[model samples]
Target chain A: MKADTNLSEGSGIPAEARKILTQIETDRAAYKRKLVISFIILAIAMIMVLIALKLDFRFMKNQLPFIFAGMGYTLLVSFMAISLACFLAVVGALGRLSKNPVFNSIASSYVSLIRGTPLLVQVYMWYLALPQIGKALEGYGFTGIQAFFTLPALTAGILALGVCYGAYMTETVRAGIQSIDPGQTEAANALGMTRSQTMKRIIFPQALRVIIPPVSNEFIAMIKDSSLVSLMGVWELSYRAIKMGRRHFQSLEMLITVALIYWMMCILLQYFQEKLETHMARGDRSIR
Target chain B: MMENDSPMVKITNIHKVFPQDVHVLCGIDLEVKKGETVAILGASGSGKSTLLRCINFLEEPTAGTVEVDGITIEAGENDKLRNGRIRDIRKRTGMCFQAFNLFPHMTVLENIIEGPVTVLRQKKEAATAYAEQLLQWIGLSEKSDEHPSRLSGGQQQRVAIARSLAMKPKVMLFDEPTSALDPELVGEVVEVMERLAKEGMTIVAVTHELHFARDVADRILIMDNGNWVEQGPPEKIFNNPEQERTRQFLAHIL
Candidate 1:
């Protein structure tokens, strides 16, 4: 309480409210500076869009849905790929930690080979090399397996992305499991929990917090990289955008719109990421 | 469960050494009778904590045998024993770490219930009830659903004590439970241990807290340089220390 007279000067209100209002007013200049900076960035982005459209604005609206149609395909592929990657990550991580040398070595080699090579090369190999693999299998008494060699474009793309991300995800899971204090396991052991019980009940829940943010980051990256699948004729958002841009001779407009859409999607992803992170962090009260 | 009054733990000529040519423990032997609380006091690197770990088979002994309730626990010729038998020994002993080691992602209730559900194969409702009772006993009733990170260090350690107790362990091994807590928080944990001792639990503890040993321990074994320098009732060990090392240890503490 500063003084009764100071409080009465504001009348019928708490002194704390008066103090808060005064502080907000005092920071008005700093708020104005931040507002100006944001406004300038928005203006620059709008001007760039206007200049791009002015150069080639013919039939832009007609191609909008055609280009935007690819968004569904993109989401469909990334969702399937991430689901498969999650499964592989769990299995591969467990295999890496397994006591059996045969399984461990197989897992180790898979991770190394997948991580060491470029993902594009793997995509090419899976699509082009699989026919040869199918042919060899047919030679081993499997007949008319040519159809097996022929993977649908979406399936090929999903397999490539899932396998590539799975390798990296295996390491993320391993690091997370290792991050837990050794004493937690020892305590679980002392309580007569079997190895599986300790892992499922005590270790995995804690490791999840460490694993999710990086896994989500990988998913976000995979969204952008899904464009590479268009090379195989999957007709995704990127491919459609390019084709329509060339047809209408408004490549700049069409491309800018696509870019803007991608940016907006990423912004949405970033928002969801922050929300998920906050939920995870809420469980660990140490921050408060 | 083993009888409450039986000799709950037996350690016979245990030795452990790492691959790096360092002899951590050499020819140690000890036994703990049920309903007795024994405190192992030692200087830094004196093998007290290692001995406690060996009883629970957490640290594999390099040689010799350990028995729990007259049953052989761990056996090997000159190396770490077979994993299956070592895990069997661990089942009979409940261990509490200095750092509490509560599962950070789990609530206090979940941490306490986990042991019963996994070890005893108890139903969820039964385990939850058992854990709730233990939580109440440990004075953490208000924080049953709270994660370990939110609890005070002393409260988390109490939750750990309750978690270990839920398994109905024949023996409890505490490795410096209070050493990891803030100085002001030490009394709360020591008081919990005192209550457990009063209830006649067979416990082996490694600690630097002279007051806990003085008040609660039936016998105190002082170690120096990986050997038991002295062992007797705390009265004789702390007040009338016989060996030079024990005398020096007492001098530093008292």
Candidate 2:
């Protein structure tokens, strides 16, 4: 391989430089070969997908619009839930990090309890158990309590998801805040800034750069997790797919279609996550 | 210079004890007159930095009082200093750290202006103008918009100095400001401190750089085991120290 470097010989380049260039050219060729192999693998996966569909393309095409219509609800639940989760995570993290015993216990218990229980059970508790508690209160002469407790399916789904994810994200947020050096806090304090002021202006802003990427990752997972809301009889993508599949007795087809849709949505979100990571990292000299 | 006899900073019997009976500072007392520079020299863990931190209450003294620019804070079990009182003392004293500790998320100019705008509630434009001037003084005007991570260690330390100066503090505290820098880069930061000292800024520094202490400080104090072993003018302390401990420490370092 080294003997074939006549390309740069006439350009008066040194032997060491020409050898390095040859290595780079070899690397580029290997990368191109790998790219071609990756595409072939993807083509094989597509063929597997076709076999899984059992050549029922017409049925999938016809059901696509009906299932796609529920996408709005799916996205809405995830977005609103994630927003609520972020707010709760910040508060919970602060609570967990607080010096006061009461705040610390409340934050730790919230995380422990939520994370310990199953999300499905929590969803049912929000949609079903709350109304029962409200009814019990109504028996004590609390007028309109049952009605207030009985939430719509979408609202209950968002609450359950948000509370659950908030518990998980509390740890993430706490780790991000702790990742910052203590010197930063001392510097801010030395400048006469109050504790809260230091946190708001100096600590939190820097922590956000560390927290955003993982938070985005949680968001992608929530997109798929939002499907759990379908059990509440909401018209989200999964509910619509399951309902249509049962009606037409093609459950496998509907399930496969909905799975692909969720995968696509996550891919789109991952793209946006990379863009956000880059934006947050602008202060750093290294882009990646 | 002798006309102003009032002390800019006064400390009385300050004692600091860490948990588990680690007595880091014990019964230390000192005073600095206005416009005078005091340099403290000691081996590491001798409480030199802790005493400086006590001045701004970054490390609260378990006993004794620290009075800065006429405001006094005393340590006692029943008497807790209010938040406002701590802020008042902190605002009057500027601190420069060995690691620079510049806010990595902000540009150099923003880092400088942060204390002015947030703590002092100065107008943004006015704070920025002062920050720019400080940057120019430190010869970092060209790097104003750059983040602290992008600058060299020397440049970041200079920027850190500028950040402290933006608050217009009555006194400056340097905690081994040049100890973290490369040997070649230490000169730039030391030069800035020398310039500041010459301009009549009151400074108390804990440093390992012997040249900086000798050339820049008006008075020098040597500490060992949380107590001052010797104190005098730099020439007297460096050439003819009274204490055996101070002599040994200097012999090891110099």
Candidate 3:
């Protein structure tokens, strides 16, 4: 406070300006203090609730290593699936934007069919129904078809998640692409750029800035949704937690532990997403 | 064979009808000779901008033909052929919009070089060199690395003109280039345009600035509704327009 006054006086700030600055500084200090107090209160409330719940800390600790070990598979599936989803989303968005009726119909139908069905049903179809169809195809004398259709649990999980998320992300991608001003396209066209050239050089670059935050959001949701693979015996986080809990008769403890783990992973992803948002927004003067 | 005498830009019976029967351009015929500057003055919604847009096929005309530099694209042609011809016309014509639609993602130099590098397939180094020269000509060499959003409206408009010029187009089309600028900032953009005009660039400008029309334009055309009512030398149109519609329009604006 002394230093602030000294600087203000040395700088010869007007009295009115000095008063406003001091008020702003005081408000900032009060805000910081309030935030700290709120955090402490929340932390205490969480501890009290946990104590009241009488959770099995010892059992939860024993199961931690096994459940944590499954994080690798969870992250691996999510990473691969998100990559596939991104590729499909770009292709789907292009198809949606295409003037060709055939492409538009196919893209719209894909989005509709996938989004209309439940992810659980889609997962079951990938894991179980595909092999049945392959067998039926084999009955038609198509050799080696069953082998092609019979995917491993991991591949089926990735496919289900990727294809499902791809449909949703297609709309996100389309909105992002459409968010660009039509003048940008006209400018590119006036400069003699072909449609594809304009899309690649001008439209997509601008659209990616608008698309990324939501894409990251979808990815975070995908991380949790990946637990659906546990139903297919993929032995991921939830799978391991469930197996351990049933064996030890500490289902509540294990469930809560796994939930916290998922929460923590999402938090980490959210932190990185914020960093990326800031990085992408650096060029936009309006945001600052 | 008589390239010097032939019109550089010729529009015959150009008509543009938007959906729901909005006739934006109606049977407009215009001819711009080589190195000639034509200023089209009109009030808001007078279709002057639409007429300019139709020249480059930015807005496809409902009916008519646009011939730029001996290449003609007629309305209702086969899609593939018409698109190819439209591209050819666009290649030869540089357009400056009222909104100064510089690619917000690119720096000033990058925005100028994008057309040459991507469309013209020039070497990046050569495009950059030319862009730098154009930037200097526009007196925005210091803003080469700055993004469009960082620049003022006038600066952005000047950069937009420089971006168009880097293409070395046969004809420059300005669609109310100074309309979006602050009153004080309009002169910089106007000055740059005046320089381009003095350098003998073939230009078709749709504008409201009466002074620019009077001083720089070789011919002045006053448009009302969707058709030009009076067209002549700057003095004749500004001082002694023969049409009552032109007189009324001039009176309102002046």
Candidate 4:
């Protein structure tokens, strides 16, 4: 018994250490099983890809580079449109939160009208109707109205997408602003801050934490919805793919390639979104 | 109650009726002289907190006149002042919350200096220097760089008091500053308040701690159903009961 005790102590592996080692082993085994499952799923995905490649992919092979080149336009339009949307969303959120009836009604109408109509219809309206108004203005001897009304197809598409997305994002921003505890506002007021000062100094900083995740989600969705801009004859990813496929009568191959590219872009965006979430949650981690 | 000096804070016939005719504060009249620490004690929903909140216009009294350091604001039925006057009144009063509502995104030092630097338009370095002193006074100098979320309940409340002090308001309002604290954490906050009282700070506190009221408060006001049931020196309020309601409340809480 003494030898056994001495050996165990000398080896530095006590009962508690053995228990921890067993727990670690179980955890590692569970992780290994998950890895195996992921590999199986990846293999299935690879097999599907092989089957798709075996199909009539000659047109896709020739056109993939050109369609991929259009990724730049797709990204550029999405970036500009999303930037514009964020600005409009902030302004709309303020209007929604404002007590003034004029601002309130204007914001309410904008959101109702935009959200009520489909994006496709709005794109057409911007692309088609504005130039008609420009021509009518020219007929009425308002020659300077040309710049105001006659927007290029790309410009119209961007504005329509921005305005429509802004309407949806307004509600998200409003909810985020309101979700902060009333106690925070009360505290700010009791500290002698005016309403705007309170909002700028205390409330908005906190609200941004809750607002960012959903806003990032909207951005991801915006990248995909940007395809609708292609309807206005903007040479983006989907437009290039469609044009190429129709010319070669192999629409399925070109469309599938575009879909894969979109999937890859979305995956990349999700990875960055997770990193941003971790960065934002740094201050909250200690307490949680 | 003094002859020559004006009241540090005075509220006359303040009334608050919420929507659906629920009267939260019904005709509260109060006066606290300079250097006086008054404790208003009552059970939850008894309107003690509401009365305290109304003094700072945190809840706009449906009817009342409030004077802080002789600057007065009056409100009647459908009569309200512009945001300017409200802001003016609030600047003269510093309030500490029960939840220690420090701006979580800011460090303790930043929370302390925000009001002074922004509303008061004090120089940032001067405000920061003063904040350092206040933090030191509250025994939180070491934690100035840390965020509120990382601090314990007691530490957060102390930093909150320091934040209020940084504004240099004429009077301090504490709304049950320790009611949310852990049992072990309550004493630290109470000790800080005790020190503030000894240093002659004008304070109106809505509190649940009977011992704090009995020991530190110059006067004790007991409320029930939005009315003050009793008000007197702490010894009289604690030892020589005048109203049955006061006695019952003491029995329940103490």
> Which stretches in model 4 have alpha-carbon errors above 4 Å?
A1-28, A39-46, A49-53, A56-59, A135-143, A286-288, B1-4, B77-81
iRMS of every model, one decimal? 2.8, 2.7, 2.4, 1.8
TM-score of each: 0.90, 0.94, 0.96, 0.92
Q: List the candidates ranked by DockQ, beginning with the highest.
A: 4, 3, 2, 1
Regarding TM-score, does 3 or 4 come out ahead? 3
Across residues A18-97, which tens digit of lDDT does each residue of candidate 1 receive? Answer: 78766766688689999999999998998887976575544667777888889998999899988999899988998898
DockQ of 4: 0.64
Candidate 1 lDDT at A150 equals 72
Please list the C-alpha lDDT of all candidates, in the order they appear: 0.83, 0.92, 0.92, 0.88
- Which residue pairs show collisions in model 3? none
* DockQ of candidate 1 relative to the true structure: 0.53
Highest TM-score: give the candidate number.
3
Candidate 3 residues lying further than 4 Å off, grouped into runs, are A1-21, A286-288
List of clashing residue pairs for candidate 2: none
lDDT of 1: 0.83
What residue runs in model 2 are displaced by over 4 Å at the alpha carbon?
A1-17, A286-288, B1-3, B76-81
Give DockQ per model, in order.
0.53, 0.61, 0.64, 0.64
Q: Model 2 chain B, poorest ten-residue lDDT window? A: B75-84
* Consecutive 10-residue window with the lowest summed lDDT within model 1 chain A: A1-10
Q: Provide the lowest-lDDT 10-residue window in model 4 chain A.
A: A1-10
lDDT of 4 at B29: 96
